[model samples]
Target: MVFEYILKQNGIHPQNDLTIDQSIDFGSTAAAFAGGNGDFTVEFEPGATSLESEQKGYVVASLGKDSGYIPYTAFCAKKSYLKENTDLIQRFTSALQKGMDYVQTHSPKEIAEIIQPQFPENDLKTIQTIVTRYYEQGTWKADLIFEKESFELLQDILLDAGELEKRVPYEDLVTTTFAKKAVK
Candidate 1:
C-alpha cells in the first residue's frame, strides 16, 4: 500500500505509468531484482543492502521516509479484551516505549552489537548500515502513539488501493491512552 502510495505521490501512476510485477513473492523480491526482473524494487533491510553490495540495484528512494508515520509494528486487541486487560496492555506499551527510547538514545553501532545474535549471518557493518538507514529515515516514532494524521493517511492508502470500502474513524479504532501513559 505504501509503495503504491509513494509512487502516486511522486506523480507516477502505478498501474498506468509503469509495470509492477507483484507476482514475485515477498522474500524473493530482492532476488528477482538481482536476477534482473525489474527496473526497481522496494526492499527492507538485508535485501536492500545486499542489492547494493552485489551491484544489482541502487537504493534510490525510501517508501517509509516519504510515507510518514506508519504503525509498522502495532498491537491489536478486541475492545473487551483490552478493557479486561488494561494492565497488561499498559505494560506492553511501556515496554515498547522503552525500546523506542533506547533506539532514540543509542548509536547504530551499539544497537547492531546488541542485536547481532539475531542475525548471525550478517556482519556488524551490514546491521549497522541498516540501523543507520532507519535512524536517518526517522523510522522509529518517539512514542507508540498512532496519531490521527497518520491513521487517516494510512486509511487513504488503503482506500486508494481498494482495500477499504469506507473510512474507519480514528476514534473508532485507535486509543492512544496506553501510549500516552507510557510516554509519561
Candidate 2:
C-alpha cells in the first residue's frame, strides 16, 4: 500500500505502471531480485541492511524516511480484555514508553547491547546497524499517542487500495485515553 502511495505521488498509477509480483517472503524476494527475475523489492531491517553490506542490493529509497511517521506498530486488545485489564495495559504502555525514552537518550551501541541477548543468533554488528538505522530514522515513538494525521494517511492508503469501503472515524478506531495518561 505504501508502495502504491509512493507510485501515485510520482504520477504513476501502480495498476498501470507496475507489475505486481508477490513473493512469499523477503529472502525469496531478494533472491529473485538478485537473480534478475525482478527489478526491485522492498525489504526491511536486517535483511535490507545485510543485502547492502554484502553488496547484493542497494536501496532506491527509504519508505520510513520519505513517508514520515507512518505508525508501523500498535498495541491492541479485545474490549473485554481491555476493560478487565486497564491497569495491566497502563503498566505495559508505561514500560514501553520508558523503553522508548531510553532508546532516544542512549547511543545505538548501548541500545544494541541491551537487546543483543534476545537475538543470540544475530551478530553484534548486524544488531548495532539495525539499531543505528532505527535510531537515525526516529522509528520508535517516545509518546504513545496515535496521531490522527498518521492514521488518516493510513486510511487514505487503505482507501486507495480499495481495502476500505468508507472512512472510519478516529474515535471508533482508537482510544487515546490510556496513551494520553501513559505519556504523562
Per residue, candidate 2 scores C-alpha lDDT tens digits across 1-184 of: 7887878987988888878787457567766766777777788766777777888888777788776678788878888889999999989888888887788889999999999999887888989998988887778877889999989988888898899999999888788888888778
Instruction: Supply the TM-score for candidate 1.
Output: 0.96
lDDT of each: 0.90, 0.83
Q: Stretches of candidate 1 above 4 Å error?
A: none
Candidate 2: segments with Cα more than 4 A from true spot: none
Best by lDDT: 1
Model 2 error, position 3 (Å) = 1.1
Top candidate by TM-score:
1
lDDT by residue for model 1 over 1-184, one digit each (tens)? Answer: 8998888988999899999998989999999988889888989889999888888888998888888877677778999999999999999999989998999999989988998899998999899989999988888888888899988888899999999999988999999999999999
